[model samples]
Target: MSVLTTKEIMDIIPHRHPFLLVDTIEELVPGVRAAGKKCVTYDEYYFRGHFPQEPVMPGVLIIEALAQVGAVCILSCEKFKGKTAYFGGINNCRFKKKVVPGDVLMLETELIKQKGPVAIARATATVDGKVAATAELTVAIG
Candidate 1:
């Protein structure tokens, strides 16, 4: 019914600082789609070593953020509340651009299919409304 702030999202997803990439979920329609934000910062732990001189958000983390958005979508469903949604797999994942500090990543995730306890979704991370990364993420309730 309402967008979830970072605090509310933290309560729903089991991710902590550094790994907690999604800063806020602006919109979520249970069992359908969700949109969120990840504000990149130079102070991030990974940035300290990701390339001291030239820090950049790793492509893998981008995919993970996307999947987490999907997870929020699934867990938003009443039945999966408080239940952990594990990443089953990622297919056709591609990084089209580099993500750096100060970039506000808009995570958009859409449910493509769901069967039993398995859910498949399409996700994308964008900066300045341009595609940064995309993938088909499979999640399972465990």
Candidate 2:
């Protein structure tokens, strides 16, 4: 079961179709953590040019998905509601596996630190229980 559908996620984040990566949020704790999923399909816009022969989900997009999950966590808070979370920075990022069509990317992010309008989170993306990517993200709310 999902805690937030794509529509609900859109209500929280300022992302639209062809750019919004997360399909469903399964778990969430305002200002703390979130878990979401993205179903990879061959029809995704990026696949059209990213490698016509053997399409692969972009590594940056994996991090963006994680950031979006973190944004949902932060933006859902009473104080931060209606605010935008900008990417302050990305640290210690690593990609372990290639995500492809038919893969369900399971994304998780935990808010590790926050000060004033800036925050940090530990993020990870997986497919079939295997790590696809991991990173530390810095976000600034405005």
- Clashes found in each candidate (C-alpha, N, C closer than 3 A): 0, 0
Cα miss at 136, model 1 (Å)? 0.4
Residue ranges of candidate 2 with Cα displaced over 4 Å:
none
Work out the TM-score per prediction: 0.96, 0.99
Tens-digit per-residue lDDT, 1-142, candidate 2: 9999999999999999888999999999999999999999999999998889999999999999999999999999999999999999999999999999999999999999999889999999999999999999999998
Off by over 4 Å in 1: none
Best-fitting candidate, measured by lDDT? Answer: 2
* Deviation from native of the Cα of residue 109 in model 2, angstroms: 0.2
User: How many clashes does the backbone of model 2 have?
Assistant: 0
> Model 1 reaches what TM-score against the true structure?
0.96
